[model samples]
Target: MYMNKSHSRIISMVALVATIFVMLFSVAYSSGHVNHHCNDSADCPICSMLAQCESSLKSLGTGLIAAVFYAVVLSQIFTVSLDYKYQSVQTTLVSQKVRLDS
Candidate 1:
């Protein structure tokens, strides 16, 4: 399982997209079937599904929000650090062993 950085990134992006789609589908399904016609029984499939969707929305919504916030912050931090490093690391003629003799 020796995957490269680009491959890993693509896989992670796909997984994230899949998760978002699932959450969106859950939201749509739950809302569209809010007034489901079913007896208030202990083993109602619709009720059980709605409950599961509710839980997924709660957990995934929170997790996605936090992940987005952290990702933005970290990207900004890395950009600034890289810019600083590039700007600070300068080479002179002397450092490069270049000389002018008389």
Candidate 2:
């Protein structure tokens, strides 16, 4: 089986996208989300801070993951086009063989 450069690029892009998603999910659940300070219920600044920080972390993580997906998708799109070209060549070769045999 012949492997094309485009196939390699597509696999690489998929790996990159998967890596980005894992990084984002990890940061969302693994960051410092603990409450170490106490204040009045109406003015629980520590809790508010943690919430805001977690929100920001989630947003940033998601954005980074999306960016990586976009880049990888672009790379894979080109690879898919190359694969299409390969498919056409393959079909033509098979048809030629059929004609030569007859």
TM-score of each: 0.62, 0.42
Least well predicted 10-residue stretch by lDDT in candidate 1: 81-90
Off by over 4 Å in 2: 1-41, 82-102
lDDT of 1 by residue, 1-102 (tens): 799999999999999899989898899999899778877746898888898899989999899799999999999999898887435468898877988675
> What range of 10 consecutive residues in model 2 has the weakest lDDT sum?
26-35
Which has the greatest TM-score?
1
- TM-score, candidate 1, is 0.62
Write one digit per residue (lDDT tens) for candidate 2, span 1-102: 888999999999998897677556555544554536565645876566666666766776788899999999999999898777434445566676655655
The list of candidate 1 runs beyond 4 A from truth reads 72-102
Q: State the lDDT at 100 in candidate 2.
A: 60
Model 2: lDDT of residue 51:
62
